[model samples]
Target chain A: MTDGLWVYLAASPLLWLAGTLVVWIAASSVAKFRPGNPFLNPIMLTIAAIAGILCATGIDYGTYFEGAQFIHFLLGPATVALGIPLYEKLSLVKSNLVPMLSALVVGCLAAVGSTVFLSELFGFAPAIVASLAPKSTTAAVAMAISSGLKGDPALTAAVVVFTGICGAVVVTPMMNAMRIKDFSARRTCVPWDWHRACLLRGSRRRIVFRNSYGTECNSNISCCTSVSVSQLDSEHLHVDAERRQAHKRDQGAGCRLSQWKSEPGKHRARTRLDAINGQQPRRRPYRRGPVD
Target chain B: MLNGLAILFTFQLAGEIVAYLLGGWVPGPVVGMAMIAVALTLTRSTSFLNPAHEGTVSTSKTILANLGILFVPAGVGIIQHLDLIRDRGFALLAVVVLSTVATLTLTVWTFILVKRLSGGYGND
Candidate 1:
């Protein structure tokens, strides 16, 4: 090669980055394309396409790796940047922490275990198994795991990238399918029937009470009736959340009407009583204190 | 960019020290992240999340955005492996395709199973 050609060849990294950026810019202009989604992500597609180019040209891996290393540098911080989303969703993480940690552990184990086992059973060689072991985590984490295990980092890196791409793409469809199953299992039904049952029972129960003036009259009848209604209905339509809310509102109005009748002198006092003995606190059994 | 530099330096320092202390079992960044999360919670403040100091984050992204050139070196490795094509080409292809499939399957399955157990009941 001529000296000018040699000088040009040495500047390949700048060309690669510029080319990749151009690809991203083009992909973004496409309406159907989405970043982060494996199917449409420009970065991933570009990476794959570039790899294809190198493979076709029979270029040395060392030279390709040099140009690619700049992109690789960003991987570390991008892995860290995941914390930004994690932080935004921190409340969800904290509130459902047990589930989150449990998910992480279970997900990691199932991922590594199943992949390793199945690959072995299917007769993949040891290098491939070592490479496959860290596919669930981000590329940086996967790279570390592979290196620690003495696996080929390149193969591990490739697997990690592909896994991330698939996750970005397939997660949505998978979730939609699960929701379909959840909805199909518990068909929504109104709670009117349960309230009617409670009302019928209440009608038979004789709800007469002493008025504020000490005269004999029905009092807080609606409240008592609604409570009975909600209880009776809880069994039949447990997942009919909307119906339950509506029933509770109807019950509350009934309670107020009856309460006024029973104690025209002290509606506030009756509310105070309700407040004193209302909802119970929720208990979380697995917290196990700070020591654990 | 400066703010980002601070964040990066902070995490890098924290990660290196913690990882060193821990015998490098896990990564330094992981430790730094945990520490930052803990710190933010204890402070119970969103000031740390302010966009005012986030020029660094934007610039850092820009740097990454302009980073397509780095992969060419690794991509060049295909040159020496051309003979492997005449020999172990099929084996290499099998390894790549199978590994990709296996990785995808494991991630999806685990995420599903975890969500089920956690009662989150969905994917992304």
Candidate 2:
């Protein structure tokens, strides 16, 4: 009777949803304690924990996925929802159109070219090479591209996740060490969501300030700005703190533009920082006015 | 929430139609994303699909917040390829890591160089 019950429970779709949510919540809670360690990446932890459970229970992946498809279906709408952020940042994107387009083309080509060349050099099968070709793109898009090229969608999905984690772990520290602080370049190269999640979750300080050259300094960590970039001095740091506080206070009110108007220098710095970070400073509703 | 979803699906459906007509050279969702992005740009001055609207923003955030969950099913699919991975795990790891770093570095540097050559930071 118990074995029969176990089989029925394992086959239910609710089992997968409940298991995934419980594991993810537990992993995220654990991650909070470490605060800034990439190894504790919540997604990685949750995947391991659940995979271990599935293996131990001898439940096949197909059964689990059958239940999990409910969550998976949301990915389509979520992907389409990416337009929200892209829409929010339309003006910034429009202003930098030329450079942004060029960077995107170059980045896409480099991602595919390097993966293919290295996979070939390493003697990976052609299918594996094809899967790796679109590894840097979002998983849904990568899977489609991989299928079109005759690669395994499952392998492509796995590689895409691996690539994201690798980029999250390696790139930030490498860029910091090299002192490559150009905001435009960073914005152009790094996918927006990946960069935000990695930087925000990994650092205790919530707000990051970019100096003119693009080096990011944690502004709120010490109740004062910690200026790590060589070009910025204490004076700029002081101004950055004031501006950040003002911006935060007004953030809820959606009056970022008004605050910006109050201090042109602060506004310029804030805009520059937002651009560099690939974030948009929150703004109030659009109003038809001569001053807007 | 429903309205936001409606807008999303509508655009996705339109993209599918276009892609189908064009023989699927590009993926439908991607084309849909571009179409939505273009629509947003055109409608920025109006409130038609203002992303800042409370309902839309909150709904979009909820969907994106759990974005990792969407990839879980696919990641679990890795179980099927365990044999291939076991045989070439080390080489696969090395290539993925090296190629990712190389691509990121090259992309960032190339963008910076191009931006500088184009007279820096454009009009913004």
After superposing candidate 2 on the true structure, give the runs of residues whose Cα lies further than 4 Å from its correct spot: A196-292, B44-54, B121-124
Deviation in angstroms for A282 in model 2? 20
TM-score to native of every candidate shown: 0.56, 0.76
Per-residue lDDT over A1-292 for candidate 2, one digit per residue giving the tens place of the 0 to 100 score: 9999888888789989888878878877787687666566666677778778888888888998888788777766665666665554455555555655666666666777777898899998898888778777777667777888899877887877777667767776767665666654554555532432353242212344211112111111110111112112211122244555565565533344455545554555555455333354423234121110
Per-residue lDDT for A259 in model 2? 58
| Tens-digit lDDT string for candidate 2 (B1-124) | 8767777777778877987898986767666666766776666454535544456656766776567667777777777787988999988898889877877777677767776788775566
Q: Can you write out model 1's per-residue Cα lDDT over A1-292, one digit (the tens) per residue?
A: 6879856875687755565556545643441233222344333455566667666655556665665676666645543433333343355444444433433444445556666776676676687677667655444555656777777666655554445444433333443444422221111110111111111121111010000000000001111111011111111212123533554565563355454644432443343333223322111244221100
How does candidate 2 score on lDDT? 0.62
lDDT of 1: 0.42
Q: After superposition, how far is residue A270 of candidate 2 from its true place, in Å?
A: 15
